[model samples]
Target: YKSIIKTIKDTPLEEFYTSGHRTCQGCESALVMRFLAKAAGQRTIVIGATGCMYVANTTYYSTSWIVPWVHTQLGGSGAAALGTAAALRALMRKGKIKQEPINVIAFCGDLGCADMGLSGVSNAMTYDYNLLIVLYDNESSANTDIQETSMTPYGAQTSFSRPGKQRRIMKKRWKKSVVPMIIAGHRNIRYAATMTPAYPLDSINKIKKALAIGGPTFIHSLDPCPKGWDYDPRFSHELGVLAAETGLWPLYEYTDGEIAYNEPTKSIVEGRMKRKPVKEYLEKQGRFSHFTEEDIEHIQRMVDEMYEEWEIPGVMPIKSL
Candidate 1:
């Protein structure tokens, strides 16, 4: 990593993903793109899946990306990234292109990564190629009118999982713990982490580190959607912060075959800080608007067990030795 962004002041004054796209007013996914661009700088190729980022960022001829960007299929993040990297390596080998480091970042939404593109992503991690895959999870398939995705949290409302008289909560599945899943399923991956724009400096560090790391890496980012979550745009950042504060979304990284929690989450783990109530988090969004007191309590219980009993907190459960 040539430039390590330490604090707000240390951040680059230059903006790579400048303002031009038509993302929602409080779209944290846009922030993820901006941060990724800044961290990687100009010498990067961002492979975008057919999701919100692709649609919103490229409307007609205009685009926000300052560096090279390409459009891939809906479920093609893994294959696209690997192919691009391999092509670059081949070009360098045959003396067709300049032999230099060029960061490759392929991004996908929750559905694209956790569901559609998971197979290709799995295979990519097993390869010796250097690339980074970012899953910008808003929980729902926000671009497709807020449908239920596997990464969507339990009790949250979606177009398909809408609450009705027959079933109060159509979605009974818990949020998939993706980072840990990747860490366990793919031992060859050099780095994996969870980040949010609420902590931009920390996220920048993660992006830089992932690029610097020798092998395939993945990052799952929790994004608060004002439209899908049914909240005012103004509260996006606050909601993102609350997610970490309440342990609903943990900030952590898996590296060197070990896992570690970051910042606020680290404090919660060490007992230096207490995780706020999950109710405080759920009450802010309309997706959980249908959640009853019982439902909220259930989620709270899950979070409690995660910290008090889980061997790796949000990543793994440990009830037995």
Candidate 2:
């Protein structure tokens, strides 16, 4: 843990994804990409899906990616990355290329990973390719006017699920747990973890560790979107910290069939760190401003259930309402 912390603290002051891109202010996806670029270095190829990152970064007559980047269909990112990795391995084996090993990474949004690109991502995990799939989940289809995706939290207002006189409700279903779905589906995945851009050091360490582990790995990063969530751009990092502290977005990693909770989350579960109220986390964002007392109670109940499921014996007792 100390070595990993040191690696993040000692990261070179180099910007692999330089400024001047058209990403919105406080775009956490862009931050995730920047960290990934720094961790993977120059010997990497980024396979991007048809989402905000691809559209905003590679606009007409310009690009923000300094490393080799390929834009693929929304549902084709995983397949393209798998093919690239396979081709690289083939060329190296046949002595056609004498270059060092190149990392192939696919970056996609929540809609791409959980909705349109689910099959491709599942197949990639099954194939156990030497690649990394980074899912920057901002909760909505931000590129398409903030439509509600499967990963969108319940009671949050989105384009598809808005409050109206006739409906008077937001999203009805719970947010999809893609992390557990992937872990359950793929038995051979080398690494799978949940992270947030707010935790820069942890995020960087996870990316570096994923790249080092030579097998299919998945990093689900909770990227806060100011436009999508209707929050002030400045509160992005604060919201991320709140999300984890409230147990709404727990940080944990699965490696070699072992599950381990990371800091804050570990402390929260152990009762060493007090879990904050879910309302404190939600009240800051406009997306949940319409939530009534009943709505907050429901959300809090869900959080409690999650805590119960993740409780660790011999540590500390789980916090209660």
Candidate 3:
């Protein structure tokens, strides 16, 4: 660890992502962007898609990124990155852009990644493009005022699927299982699902691993949006950590050839056995503000089922909802 620290200290953090932007107070996405760029170092190109991050970090006449950056249409970031990588690779072969190796990283939100950018990402992975796609999933489309996305949990209300007497169900549809979906597409690619604030060290490590790989890599991060999650700005990290501990979200990585679970605290099983309830975390967010006792129980049940089905080593099997 001491040698690792010394090596990191020797590397410069600046000259990559410079400060000065107007991102939201509790948005974990910005912090994630900073860490990833830092890990990738100075010779990198970032492809930004339409989302809260794009609006805040690259408003007209101002930009936060210090590296070579390009913004593309929301649905085309993956493709754009693919194009950029192709052009860069071709240029290097022809001695056009200094022939120096460069890293290409794409950034997108939940809606953009799981919903809009799915096909392009799938195609890029299938082609084995040299790029890293970071899905900054804050659950809801926080930048657009919290509309429901496929990643939104059951009993969690968004404007699109708000609970009411007539339609009193939080997303009745299951959250889209994107990790497996991506895995099915490109077995050669490295894939991992992570959460910000809760597992920053693990998160950083995963980013480092993905960068080391030669082909396309996916790192999905569950960033908490305090404004959308309906919590205090400072509680963003706490909420993110609680979600993983409650079995609603698990800290795991898929790479090499199998899946590896990263449960640093053994909190999911232990916490479920002795803690007050999952309601404590749900009650903190306005997304689940309308959930009744029965609704909360339903959510817990789903979490339990997922836990059992996923079979994460060292974690207890979840009971059915």
By summed lDDT, which 10 consecutive residues of candidate 2 come out lowest? Answer: 312-321
**What global local distance difference test value does model 1 have?**
0.91
Query: Candidate 3 residues 1-321, lDDT tens each?
Result: 121222344544574666787888877888788878777778899998888889889878999898988988887878987898899888988987797768899988888888988898887786666888888888788778889888887767777887778877848877776766776567787655554655666666677777776588888887888777777888888887777766566676677767766664344544434333578889888778888899888877776566555454322342334
TM-scores for all candidates: the values are 0.98, 0.94, 0.88
lDDT tens digits by residue: candidate 1, 1-321: 566666789888889899989999999999999999998888899999988999999999999999999999989999999999999999999999999999999999999998999998998889988899999999998998999999889988889898999889898988888888898989888899999998999899999989988589999999999988999999999999999999989899888898889989999998999999999989999999988999999999999999888877877765646
Report each candidate's C-alpha RMSD, comma-separated, in the order given.
1.1, 3.2, 3.6
Better of 2 and 3 by lDDT: 2
User: Where does the lowest 10-residue lDDT sum fall in candidate 3?
Assistant: 1-10
Top-scoring candidate (lDDT): 1
Ranking of predictions according to lDDT: 1, 2, 3
lDDT of 1 at 257: 90
Give the distance in Å from residue 187's predicted Cα in candidate 3 to where it truly belongs: 1.7
Lowest summed lDDT over 10 consecutive residues: which window, candidate 1?
A: 312-321
